[model samples]
Target chain A: MVKAKIYVQLKASVLDPQGKAVTTSLHAIGYERVADTRISKYIEIIFDETDLAAVDTQVHSICDKLLANPNTEHYHFELETME
Target chain B: MRVSVITFPGSNCDQDALEVFETRGHTVHSIWHKDTDLQNPDLVILPGGFSYGDYLRCGALARFSPIVKEVVAHAQRGGYLWGICNGFQILTETGLLPGTLLMNNTLQFICQHQYIRIETANTPYTHGLRVGTALDIPIAHKEGNYFIDEPGLRELQDQDRIVFRYCDADGNIAPGTNPNGALDDIAGICNTTRNILGMMPHPERAATDSVSSNDGKQIFRALEDYFTTRA
Candidate 1:
């Protein structure tokens, strides 16, 4: 089995509305120094595979083809063999 | 054509998306998020709303929904998908779409008639739109601002993968015109193939002239037009 963890985020050029809102609320509550607030997701996948490299490619392809939109998203994966 | 609008428990736009599809002469199905069977539709849409009450962040919890499992499978087979607002967030959560929708730079619950520029109109969803044209769509969200890393955004821009940018009515680059303060006024985007389009604006809300600026109709028209041409 191979386990892969994925991190996904919006591109920098796009505005992060939710993060900004949270920051605003913080400011309203007197936490005025909060410079930034951005949101993101962490995805973990475990699948059985014989070839680690092949599964690694599969993980990336999954992220590329479906998991993440390369245009507006950035995805990084950490893959390791499961004991 | 058949279109399925996914209904998450907190989803607010399922009906809106369905209504637009119906208006366009396509059969629209309201598929709940709990159902595993996709029923094999021509297209699937994740409508906007606060799914799972936006627990663990917007669209994050819904990414593990029963339906998303099947949605991922269908996408693997080259299925077409679309996401708007929270729907776009869910797609990001499920790793089906690209980019993360972060907090707005200014942090406000903005509800405004925003603008979007068509950077690339080649995809099935954007095919009918002319290059460099603009769409005046309404964007109502608390977390519609979009963000990505430097290298990643540059790659998309370099490949013309950057499809839609937020713009003024005249479609010029100006601050404050961007409702969410997105970098480059990016309001929407698509995958490399353009099969999947995720945007912040509510095209369904503006599909009718009576209620809106009528710019929303063009997005639906573009998708339907492309579907017709290919099918």
Candidate 2:
């Protein structure tokens, strides 16, 4: 079995309003020297497939087609084996 | 004209869309998201509301619903399709329309009447309205900020697909008048063929003067006139 963890975030050029709001609150609470802060989504998926190569391809396709919007967001994933 | 409104799991504006179509003297059909078969209609609309609770980003899950395939087919066959608010999000997710709606720059769910300047009256929804006419319409959403890459924006402009832009009362396009930080104050856009239109404003909410400005009703009137001319 393979488990996958995906991290999705808005592209560098896109403005992240939610992330900016969080940063503003952090500043209000006295966090200094913080130049920037961005937010991302963490998703986990477990696959029953034993073929590592095939599982990797499947996970990438899922991220490209569903987990992220290619227009404004970028995504990367890590896979590992579970006992 | 016959109108079909698709009701997703959380569509709150389906009834309003139906009523408006009926009031315009058109037959209306309500279709569910899970249903595969679609009734033939002069226009198909995807109404507003938090479809699938707007999980995993707005309009992400709802775009995969079975009925969307039929809607795509209908649009491809030269039928008219309009998506309002959440429906507009679904169109971008389904690739029926270009660009995407992002979180509002203020990070708040804004609900108010806004002024939108008509950019082009070439589509069935805007054929009767003159360019530069400002209409008072209601917009209610947290993710109505439109975004498209620079090249994409230029392409849309070149094709004249941008149908409406958020503007002030006098139709001046300026940063101060932009409710949401959209790339170009874009409020509504259509496909290159002008058949599919996706907009952030709630035209149905402003269809009656009893509650709010009826300037939005001009959209329906334009459609009726468009169909009459074609017939």
Candidate 3:
């Protein structure tokens, strides 16, 4: 079995209103020296595949189709085999 | 039937939308930002504009407006809605729609003509158009790029919710043909139910008789026809 971790976030140039709002609130609450902020989601899963290429393909298919919206968000995945 | 167009203090396209519906013989009402109780419009339109001065983020401030809350509720009940440009931003901000709008990869505002493919023309918002057809519409925005994660992107495609896409003048979805560089050259998409449409391109902007404006007339005509037929 192989485990995967996916980190997703809005592209660098994309506007993050929710993240900005939180930053504003933090600043108001006296969190100084904070220069930037962003928000993203993480997902983890286990796939029972021995072929590395097949596992990669399946993981990419899931992300490109559902886990992320490539138009606004970008995602990278990390995988490791179960011991 | 009555159509409601919500107007924020900073909204730029409210009048254009209002005129289009009025010409179609539908009663049009302009709702203010502070009114939480919507007059319950049969059709609601969130026009394109830099609402709330694009503060914090595009459509971010407007998403919290009293009018938006009611609009969100109306959509949940299977109400018909059309969001263009800034309205699209508001929809994402309010969580009424999936996927978020990000800044242009160029980090600059873009205003120009674009070719969008009709990915799914079966919805109330796109019924008049046929699948895989090409449309030439104008899109203007600083943040118009769409993004989603792996699982989420798949779910969107699997559900057949994609409605519009940027393509060549011939309606081809290719890499170099996109004006906004959207994923799959996506110009617009709908909720899983295919009732709520959020698109960055301004169909209303293309409805005018002035050069290059009437391209969006088909979209409005489709809606007008649907309402009349149901009535």
Number of the top TM-score candidate: 2
Q: Which 10 consecutive positions of candidate 2 chain B have the poorest summed lDDT?
A: B203-212
Question: Scoring each candidate complex against the real one, what DockQ results?
Answer: 0.25, 0.90, 0.08
List, residue by residue over B50-133, the lDDT tens digit for candidate 3: 998986567867876878878978988988888889998888777778877876655568999887777876788777678877
Candidate 2 lDDT, B74-174, residue by residue in tens: 99999999999999999999999999999999998999889999999899999978999999999999999999999999999999999999999999997
**Residue pairs in candidate 2 whose N, alpha carbon or C atoms collide under 3 angstroms:** none
Give the number of the best model, judged by lDDT. 2
lDDT of 1 by residue, B1-231 (tens): 788888988999889889888977888788988898877888899998889887656887787789998887777777788889998887766766556776676566788888888888778777868877878888888877676677767877887777788877787767667777566677777777667778888989998756858888877888778888888
lDDT measured at residue B91 in model 3 versus the true structure, 0 to 100: 82
Q: Categorize the docking of model 2.
A: high
Two-chain complex of model 1, DockQ on C-alpha atoms against the true structure: 0.25
Ranking by lDDT: 2, 3, 1
The CA lDDT at B149 in model 3 is 59
lDDT of 2 by residue, A1-83 (tens): 99999999999999998888888888999997677789999999999988889989998899888999999999998888888
How many clashes in each candidate? Answer: 34, 0, 30
Q: Candidate 1, residues A1-83: lDDT per residue as tens digits?
A: 88898888866755556677788889999998899987666899898886889988898888776666565667788887888
